[model samples]
Target: MMLSPSDRIHAPVVLLVNPAAGRGRAGRVAQAASEALRAADLAVDVHETRERGDEARIAAEASATGARALAVVGGDGAISHAVRGLLDGEAGGGARVPMAIFAAGTGNDFAKSLVVPVHHVARMARHIAAGNTHVVDVGFVDDVPFVNAAGFGFDVEVLEHMRTPGVLRGTAAYVSTALGALFGYRGFRANMANDSAIMSRKLMTVFANGRCFGGAFRIAPDARLDDGALDCVTIRDISPWARVPLFARAMRGTHLTSPHVSFHRDHHFHLRFDTPPMFETDGELQQAATCDVSVSVRAGALTVIA
Candidate 1:
């Protein structure tokens, strides 16, 4: 990750606060997190983000320096941005930098996968100082990298519904949007092939780098962060009513047993859609340049504070 002009100050921790992320609570989380770090006698520099790409730009800047640890005070999108900044081109394949997280995003799925409790902001701060790093794999769709989960089909539609302003939070918000999207959303025709999977009409999915999405829905029960592969869980088209039970089972991670679901894991996957596909990576919506995508793994590319 690189630093911005605002991040020129020296501190043991370079804290990136995404003020606009996850409603309005990120500022509070940033304040509380800094207090915690200062309380531990560590010099903390809190850099509040002003725009969308600041996270990546500043993170890349910080990484270019010799900053000991970089912590993010936002949801997974902020993390995604910073990771992209850090790994942009040669930076990703070079010497790695450590990172910490203070979960303040709505989904916080990626943070949760690292077992970082949003409620324990101080502990997360302390972990930055402790600097015990754990290497974890990062999944990539072409050149763009994602920290948690990424995919298309129903998940993309669910994300579209999630974009609507609502009063709910966490899983409840996701559930409300998912239910609304389920009614009218239809799957796209697609073909996929990987070392562990080869299929067509594989219209839906929740390809995971971690265990879950939608706040705790276990998208992949057997996923391991350091496993050196991505877990691909594809869902065949089913009745909207049938989706209810399957989604319920997903909560407990038993949906894999369903006949409509197929599971595979590999270092790389190739996908082609009959039409262009819109997707999401770490809760951030995206679209592919063409009807094809190549998803690959950067085995243990990130060293996270856990």
Candidate 2:
């Protein structure tokens, strides 16, 4: 259902801005969003994040002050941090606060999954004014929460490559890294189990909470934000040369039909890598680990202004 503008009721909102994100343009974008929300007659408080995980701290403080809503201005990393803070605070007997996003960072993949407009601060602000809240599901991998997707193998390598100095930035960077990794990468062995089945794979695996990643890749086209299940995708071992054509098909979401690719839905799953394998949660690479990782959906766990 589409939300109407009349639904907004001037709730108090705190906007957390990551000044260092998007090549240091997030502060400007945050300012613009704040103005737009205020223009819509909503009370707005803006804060600049100090460092990594600062979004969480600032959001917790705002919720402590009785903020009714919290909006983050940055990429998936910032949003994920803020969501963790909000969720943790609520669990710790703090006030429940609704959240929103003003997409301003590179990729903005999570925001795209929400069907939110990019490069349009006013439209985002209007959504906040509408005040319609929808319950969204979040995915948990071990103790970490990722509102986007989590993956291992090739994707994790690409994420790691992107962190290197002089690596290109934005979606283009992801594309370049993916291409480089496809030819230079070797498959890793993993043991995976979901609610209905267990399997071993020697390639890449992705567990998606949202449909898109790497800007616009519909890696999990059938994924639903409110659905109680996670969309799981696994690409079996294939020659490096074959990966090029498969990747091309993935762009159109037709790769699922390929014999080497497998897709399914599960409410919960556990994964174990044969050796310490690089893993990524919400596009951020985590330390190499030989640990057990589990993913489960917290159904309707988050209230978001949509």
Candidate 3:
């Protein structure tokens, strides 16, 4: 159903902008979105993150002050941070707050799922004011929360390569880096199990709360944000040459039909790796604290204005 613009929420919202996201695109979005929000007759408070991990602190402080909504002018990485603070803020008693995504970063996959208007800041502000809110699931790996998807193996390698993605941006950056990473990738060995099945030696394992990943790949075609279960897609180890075609098919989510891919829907999955490999939660890379990783979902845990 389409949200009617006549339905309005006049409550004040605090916008947290990540200046470094999308190579400075977030800063621009912050300026435009603030203007649009004020034009809608809504009070707006704006804050800019100066350094790493500032999103969590700023978001916590804002939510503690009883902000009606927290709008993030950045990508999934910043959203991931804001979510942690908004949920765990001591002053809020760990209560959830409604959030808005401005989609001003590379690989805005989470925002894509929300159907956020990325190219039009004015429309996005109006959408926020319309207050067509939806409650969605939030996934966690170990203790880290991710709103879109989290994974290891090949995708992690792509993230590592993304750190210095040269001149490309957005989906092009992801696709180009992944093509380069796929050739040398040796995959990994791990013991993965849930209530129904067990597996080992995989190319990549993704626990998806939303459908798309890496900006372009619909890695989990059947995923639903409000569903209680996470869609787990595990790609078995395949030759480097085989990965090329798999990558192509993943763009339209047609890769699921391939024999090497296995999909499972579950509330939780436990994995143990020979070595603690790097993993990513919402496009932000993290070194695994240990070889064991626990992925689970808290259904309907977040409220967002889509």
lDDT at 284 for candidate 3? 84
Question: Which candidate leads in lDDT?
Answer: 3
lDDT of each residue in 1-306, candidate 1, tens digit only: 445434533446778999987788898989899999888667877788899868987787667764667888988889999888767623654335678888878878887678655558878777776667798999998777998999888877877766677645566778877877776776767778652234444447767998988785888988988999989998777877887788888888999989888888888888887767788898778988888888989998888887
Candidate 1 TM-score versus the reference = 0.90
Per-candidate RMSD vs. true structure?
Answer: 3.6, 4.2, 4.5
RMSD of 2: 4.2
TM-score against native, each model: 0.90, 0.91, 0.91
lDDT of 3 by residue, 1-306 (tens): 111223214346889999988887887889999999899778998999988779999888765665657889988889999988887773356334578888888888887677768568899788877777789999999999999999989999887777773646577878988898889988888788652225556889999999999988999988999988899998888888988999899998999889888888998989888888799999889888899989999988888987
TM-score of 3: 0.91
| CA-lDDT, candidates in order | 0.79, 0.78, 0.83
Please identify which of the two predictions, 1 or 2, would achieve the higher TM-score against the true structure. 2
Residue pairs with backbone atoms closer than 3 Å in model 1 (clashes): 1-59, 1-60, 1-61, 1-63, 2-59, 2-60, 2-61, 2-62, 3-61, 3-62
Error of 2 at 261 (Å): 0.6
Give the candidates in order of lDDT, highest first: 3, 1, 2
Model 2, position 281: C-alpha lDDT score:
78
Q: Indicate whether candidate 2 or candidate 3 has the larger lDDT.
A: 3
- Name model 3 segments beyond 4 Å from true: 1-11, 90-95, 164-169, 195-199
- In the predicted model 3, the residue pairs found to clash are none
